[model samples]
Target chain A: MPNASEPPTTSPGIVRRFWWRSGQRTRLAVACAGVLGALAVTGAAGFSGDARLAERGGPGVAVHRGDSFEVTVRAVSGVDLFEGVEPGTGRVFGARVAGVSAAPCWQSQSLAVAENLLRGKKVRLIVKKDGDTGTDRLLVDVELPDGTDYARTVVDEGTASADVAARGELGPVESAARLQRRGLWAGGCTGYRDDALAPPSSTPQTSSTTAVPTTTTTTPPPVPTTTTEEPAPEPPPTATEEPGDDEWLARFEGKRCLLEGTRRTSPKGTEIVCTRGPRGQLRWQRAD
Target chain B: MRTEDHVDLFAEAVEADPAPTRVDGGRPRGLTAEGWVRTTGWLQVGDHPVSSVLLAAVAGLLWALVGAAALVTEFPVAAGVLTLTTPVVSGVLWWLFTTRLRPASTARNVDTCRADELEPGDTIRLHGSIGPIGQVVEVALDDDARVVLHGGARRTWARDDVVHLAELLR
Candidate 1:
């Protein structure tokens, strides 16, 4: 037994002090564990079965659609797991890496690459409004500390393929990776490997295919009709057509105009008709 | 001897030796000259009351139990409600601990030293929840004082609250 008056400084004293301190420490630990466990349970349940795909339409694990925030990588999944407090609201959110398409076979290696390059490092994410192909996963462009593009790096190293529809600028880098047989391009991953050999134009098929036929059918007839009808009245401007100047002037005819740091407003409900002279100087004409 | 007579004798002895003396031989191993001892109590460094800890634990366990029940009953709506309430519940518990459950100092025998005896840059501990070590940044002639505590955050306190002042042992 210890003396009552003596200061408790022995090993037993230290143990007693720790025991008293444990109450507060245990409370803090339980609080944190409780919250985290709740999140884990809910997250698991949310992603269960067919509801997993539907949950993608809801807010993401770390971010919502169109959220731009800075995050630090906590763990690496197929994409990096990042956490940051949302600006203006101070609400905490997690964000996964966006704009890279890692094939299923290459996910583990891609995750390894993400860990090697981004683990415990700060990165900025610009969340895209369109959700990822993976149900409910946020699409974000992960930028490294020194402004290196995470998706471009992944594609350049052949760890993942460039998401052409989402990240068009990475097409050239993806081609380079394929030519060098890097990453998934190394002959075994058939889907992305074949994509590398196809022309970059093939990826924009949805928009480009529709646009090409419409423009070809409608554009030629209008040019001849406009040239013939307006030839005499608009001689000075038509003489210096300069290819598409007529269409260019026509686009802004009825719009509010800004020129040389001046706002040009028409009080009489008039249109600003613009023309290019022979020397390429712009002439603004007001028409009511 | 009568109890009053014994108290008078002890008071006279204390006044005779105003300066603190070392105990045992060369300064007691853990007790500072200012009388700070490393231990957990109502006034210990970074210690929360056991009651506060119990309160937080109960709150957490309640959240977990309700969340589990919501999942079991196939009540996604209830689960969602519980999920949204978790942070608010934790924040309320933290506020309760800080504002209501924190201990107050009732120590009648609080040791004190004169402001003149302590110089600028002396380490000290305040008497309240602002515990856990601070350095005296300034000491004014009129008993006005300033201390730089945790993370260079400065605070002002009266001369009476300056409970312990001593050189920090390296």
Candidate 2:
């Protein structure tokens, strides 16, 4: 009874003091977090700023000595990464790729632009330092609108993945046989390293005879055109029209080189366009 | 998943893309455009991984325990050393946290080939209306039956001639 009478009105003070002690640890932790956070902010700002500065290529696009590369700097939908040459040349740069001038990546230095391009997008920049081959290497860097950038080392030949990336087999067997007779690419794609190619081709499947669509023969009837509308003043070319591989081959034969070099696509697949370069100078562009 | 370490590494196979570009239709390209490859392989550092990160954390924990034991009592002189080490350990832990938090599973465009589709291996022709978006590739083998190729289907098909489908279906 006597002990119960007074467990100390001060017991509340002990509890409060305990809480204060606990609170001190939490406050210390919060303070540490705040300091660390500020340090992190400063560190990140300094680091990212340095990276950006490095990216700008203040030294101004220093290439090797004489490296020539094929490139396609154009307007990609409303997001071009090039500016027209104010040095008084019509040659468009990456800033114009998206068809606008303010693509954040459009650095005036040729080297800096080379350092920033999308994977498949093309731009011709030469790495000419002093002694490297004039056409030393092809390089491109791309920065997506969302602050992500990608780079690709352009190869001398489109052979990094496959010696022959061209699609479609001999249009018809007889045509394939003719190609065999010509021994295209050491008898055509059959020459790609058997081991390098997945599921190695063992017997070299040769299709000297034509095989029609065995999957399903639902060839739609040819739709004839009436040419009802008036043609535009200067119609764009019809490079993308679908045709048989043999037909394409025929056209390709007439045009040994694609005239225009390669095809490119924006990340969103919003659009794709064709481009070409001769000895690394961007020469043509098509949207078909 | 370590069991898959030595397996065919399609785990890192990026979305499929066709090399020789073609136009499908008014907006059509060949089925090859929507082509893809299956693979399995090691992911790059800063990429996306679960087991590797966990293993790192575990290893760090062991080192931290050793560090703590060294700084207690007899080595109170090294307590400052331990304090300095804490943040270095903390930085690594933070990076691991960030890696887990911000992984590189970014969405990318890709396409693939299938068996018994319009571009069947035996056949070289694929006649179908690829859905407006390159997402729903409806290769119509028959009017009532349109085989749908989904996922990565972004390519320009310029030629719709009869061609081999087997090449892309690997």
Candidate 3:
């Protein structure tokens, strides 16, 4: 009979040997993970460092360009940004003009107003830290040097509408601007289109009106404090009445004009000049 | 019937019928059962799913990309906001991904095993605690209802510690 023997153990193949020997694959995986971790850390740090470097504009400048919004000025210690707010750290920060909602078409006009009023000027910022807007810009009530409300000016000029959430004075100002068909509201907001301008019935359904939030009552409460250092002058009276079929010149009043120097004679023989409005849109105004 | 004669007979039987050598102790050759299960879209590291980790990584990458772009454009406030909220956003996303993927049965598996039910040499993974796989050493269910487990170190854990008891197939 043959002698009994133990079966021969075959050696592991190259792949298995590589995988199991001293946990080589695990070490490789760990190393790869470590590299990825290092990259992520480096990327984050680089981004943060770049952001920090970009925050400041220049030393000793009173009004500086904001890193996020258009401008940044110090709050408190007489940075002259807002009134009746607690003093802050005086660090430069971005501030959003409260109570104005500038639609896309009117954004440039509102921005122009902001730049003119705020750039190289001392202003006040009443900061509200109630909730996160997902940006570093603070929600604030901005006031120009002459104590004119910045957001109110934008709304009153019809460059922007009152924010639906706005309380106090801005709502009434916006409603009055809309009623007068000022700036963007000219020719019922569809003045840019020929058909909408010819027919008065289609005026109410214009898409531009949708930007105004109708949730707030159209008639706002009377503002108690009307006394101000510089009250905005009332817009010059244009031909506001709905035009008859024969009245061609009457239709051009408060409507966007093509040329800056264009002049037309009204039925009353008064000269009307196409002049740029406060909201940056060119409209026919009575020649003073 | 003698012990020596029986040992010699067993040795002769083993030589007569030799079994084939299996490197993985006759278990499935390529991947372990757990590894095969992981391929079915339920990958996890301990209690957290691998998908959550990957999702958080992608989110972090996007956050970094946007932040870098914002910084290059000199929008420091936007970059600051993105940088500051990265960890929070990643954490929330990881939590959401893990919550969405975790199987209902696996979550309930923690309550299934107790110290009294465990026997010596039973291998288990604990929930809500970070440690290596534990091998039950002793089940001391006296006052504290703790089980002694030997993994790298011998330690006593509560009855509720065992999240899942796994049987290794060989």
Candidate 4:
């Protein structure tokens, strides 16, 4: 009989040990397969299409040369792979739509819409021209079995923007979607209209509009007061007060003016008083 | 003989028997009658199947083979995409299973003792305010229900709070 403190020679313990050893072997095999698979993919790609094209024409030439062909959509990767055209050379070329910009927030939805419309289905691809980077830019116009225009459908559903270099007449469809607040137009592209109306470069000068009126109004009062006090020995204090007042008013330049009030000054030279509060509201002053 | 004396004589005779007769002792092989009943009702592997890690490993190998075939057939982009994404997806699944969705241990012989049935020298795994893992040293069933843990630290627990009692396997 086995000692009570020692473990029993149980069948369950043997089964557990076998499973543990098998689990370790499985993990090692999976890791090795992953590495080998990655290497095989890279080696295959290097020996075929794009690498050959790159070597022939200084590393940036178009791999897929033909214009019009029938191809199937293999995969969707945001705006990059709008259509995947396989030109029978066993190489797949990713084709971006000639004019469409799917915003980041709408990318997944756009991909889903594209996949639903074209995945595993044959479609006619009309390559417009080589894009800026010499890759094929295609104009994919496919009618679904139910007669839905694929490219126009994506634009009309507000998933992709039509204002990307204007290659097709998708503006009207996009406009209608924006008005109806459908898809990404429904708060996804927040401030898109404002951003489009006022370009980034011109935004800072718009704040200067408020500064113009405040400077014009305050300059007239100081000029008259300075001239009247010019004969008095109080010219030094009045001169200092004018510059300080301008500096103080400059701090509230871009803020909204909730109220406006007359300016007041303190008797002591230490504090220059103003009726304006930090929140742009004017505190009322009693008559002297 | 009296009726009680006759019953005692029969019980002594049964205990003195050399054969391992059922119900001769208080419990056969130190197992309670309730425990024996549960053991008989244990689900066999064939009756109620569970997933094996070996099956998952085989599936992974098949997936890798498919990916390799795609690469050789000149669908390198598709194959490459799958190869890159598989590890990331697998890592996420591994994290989910290990950290968030770990299945509780189902070793019935180790986890089948009830709290009320705990005796002296019986160890238990407690889950409560003190911590998730605990071992019982001694138990008191007085008005103030308390247990003396392995560290000589005494803790009071409601009957329901003492959820698991560790099985003392011989």
Candidate 5:
């Protein structure tokens, strides 16, 4: 097929020529080995974006638009899902199970319960928009596969207590767990209801019991005792009554005080003084 | 064809007539990214001969598939496998292009002769392996080997390894 007048067709040399004649499978295998090795080297060297993203372990903020999404639990810290002890960074958004607070006295044990129950399990996340600030911790009802509320389960398991501050009907479940002497409740751990009764201690007081209600003198009376039966009552109307002149010109009560420590005599001859009330609001109080 | 004709045919297939002062493949050249890509990309390293530009577009597509799989969590297990494998496969394809496949395609483009036929003062590729067009130095015969200047040092290559010799043209 070659013209004698034209120069010879150059051979690619023995090895290359032999390679050229090699079977398709051998060439393909060699190609695969080289490529896979290069990728593994690149990943090991930290050059790939995928490797970087995986190392970071997902995003700090959950990128979702709707009221709910789904996620597999990566970790559990205290009562929050995917939240490390430190704030933000290398986390998949801070989420706390709605309606339950981890029992302060048994926080480590509660974390263990949560980790055992939720780790690597897929759960439906129902975001509570009203409970969230849109930036920080998101209030979510973590629902397991069978539509069971994870927070309620924790409360039932006695690892966590029902929180009046969060929305849920978990008070009765917590009460039942305590009455049955389950989990932390077996040792009479302080529940959220008990914490409200004796508010001074930052750590849950293990010795706190029904006897706390009898020590009303040492206990602040402002705490709503009916919190278990009803929603907490509105903060009692502050007793710092304004001078009444605005309501009825006949009396100088329920009116703002002119100056703190100032004293005035009412039309009925009752003495009133401007002083700071229990709520720190400077107002008129009967000096009698 | 007769036996003599077969012999002539085989000889012609292997060796080119020595021309005095071959116009090309006799001088040193500069390396560039574009030149490297041309020699390494496309189906240059494979049995398939395709334009490097076309192959680059295909590689870009593969990268997109891989990137999408990595970024989107909703993607299924198949997508995960695709993300894990595409890069290595692409790398292998590239390696094949640069080292083995591309050379097979473009080898005949340069002036070549059996290493035993090389004369003194005849410039040839410093190393016999197909790679970035390397240094071109004048070679001299030393017994059964070809001697060439490499990195300011004279090194001799066995004629068997340097079975065929060519000079860097570009």
Candidate 6:
């Protein structure tokens, strides 16, 4: 650590000028203090953090009445023969999968189910047995609010009464099982691998010849929306830190406003046309 | 005229309007580069709450930003930017403050031309938003010797523009 009295010995010319002008110690100290303060806030929030107790979605997992989405409940990881916990059944420690985790996991694991079942209110995906109950986990889709009009589910639970099939492919156990019944299942295990992934099998895709047009069309639209949305948002928190650098905050604080939706008007009759920010919350007295 | 002649003209125009009143908002009321440029303390800027708020905001915001930036990124340019901005922002802010707060100075305009009536270099009271909202440029006389009023925006108007102002005082 450099001391204040030491005068910050460094490479003399431009480098030294840069550090001095930058208020090196002051800035670093402030930044560190801010980070530490944020960490403290996070810890405080953890105590208040609500952890949803998810119920595993079972075979009879009720799908919502209308509007479609995916739900995933971890099935198993390692087989527990000694404990009588079946390869794909028995008590599974539940981790709730809501609309957030459902859509992605479904698309990645079961493309067919993702395409077809995802369009309906209820989506179910099952792959062949991977290894054991402890190592491999099952995912389930469940209805929300009993008779649902498509709402997001956070924590869902159900009984594990699912079909057990050959340890063939790494696709959804129940799905691969159904595919087994039809003899149409293609991709199962990945070739020449000891690890319990998929078996030696062809790609699950049917009509693989016209790969050009389908790949071309589906990739672009969602990428931009998803990429732009991924950045750390400036906290959409309902309550905000009180009045920071923005001077105009005072002008609107505790005042109701009917923002023309076109422009923000100041209390003193100054119409400010801007979209970026007043940089803080403006209290307003809504005009009607 | 030099490149700064336009600025010099503005300075002169404003200075002519009220020389003793144009206080630099950057430095303290009394403290100039020369140090302790005293004020009479009558028209202290603190009298207006709005002006004080504008002053505090302009100064504190700039400095606090410098402080925050130095705290966050620790870039060399932050301080440099702040130093260059202090005076410029202060001047602009002061202009804003005064434009809204300062009462317009009075100037007189009369059409009657008597030999002993209106003395040269004499200050006169004029009734209008002109003296209050904008500064008065130097008074000029055209070829006909008709008195013409010059305003801040370079607009020249004769006594004909003032129907009520001339007739009411008549």
Give the winner by lDDT.
5
TM-score of each: 0.29, 0.18, 0.29, 0.29, 0.39, 0.18
- Give the runs in model 5 whose Cα sits over 4 Å from its true position: A1-34, A43-61, A65-67, A70-95, A105-123, A128-139, A144-288, B1-112, B119-123, B129-170
User: Taking the tens digit of each residue's C-alpha lDDT, what string does model 2 give over B66-121?
Assistant: 55443332245564575556556655754444334322111111233442234312
How high is the lDDT of residue B125 in model 5?
Answer: 39
Better of 2 and 5 by TM-score: 5
Model 5 earns a TM-score of 0.39
TM-score of chain A of each: 0.41, 0.22, 0.41, 0.42, 0.43, 0.17
Tens digits of per-residue lDDT for model 6, B1-170: 33554444334343333311222313222212221112110111222212323433444444545443433222346556665665466656554443333311112223323312333232221222111111233445453223322222232345333311111010
Top candidate, metric TM-score: 5
Minimal lDDT window, size 10, model 1 chain B: B16-25
Taking the tens digit of each residue's C-alpha lDDT, what string does model 1 give over A88-162?
Answer: 433334455555776767666666666766767777778876544334446578887879788887777677777
lDDT of 3 at B98: 34
- Which digits, one per residue and each the tens of the lDDT, describe model 4 over residues B92-112? 554344223432221112333
Q: Chain B of candidate 1 versus the native chain B: what TM-score?
A: 0.29
What fraction of correct interface contacts does each candidate retain? 0.00, 0.00, 0.00, 0.00, 0.00, 0.00
Candidate 5 lDDT by residue in tens digits, A1-288 = 000011012334564434433443554565456546644554444334533433454333334434776767776767555532212222354566778776658777777667766777777778765422224556778887668788888777677777856754677676655543445665535333543322322222111222334234343221323334333434333453233443323343554332355565543346777677787545677776
What is candidate 3's lDDT per residue for A1-288, written digit by digit as tens? Answer: 000111111233453333322232463475457547756776677655544433531111122233122233433221112212112322345455567665546444445545555566666655544423222455667766777777776666666666747534666666555544555544323422212112222222222222333233232211112123343234343455333423645666787553465565544556678789999767987776
As for lDDT, the candidate ahead, 3 or 6, is 3
Say which docking band candidate 2 falls in.
Answer: incorrect
The positional error of residue A234 in candidate 6, measured at the CA in angstroms, is: 65
Poorly placed runs, candidate 2 (over 4 Å)? A1-22, A54-119, A122-126, A130-253, A256-288, B1-170
Off by more than 4 A, model 6? A1-112, A119-288, B1-55, B58-170
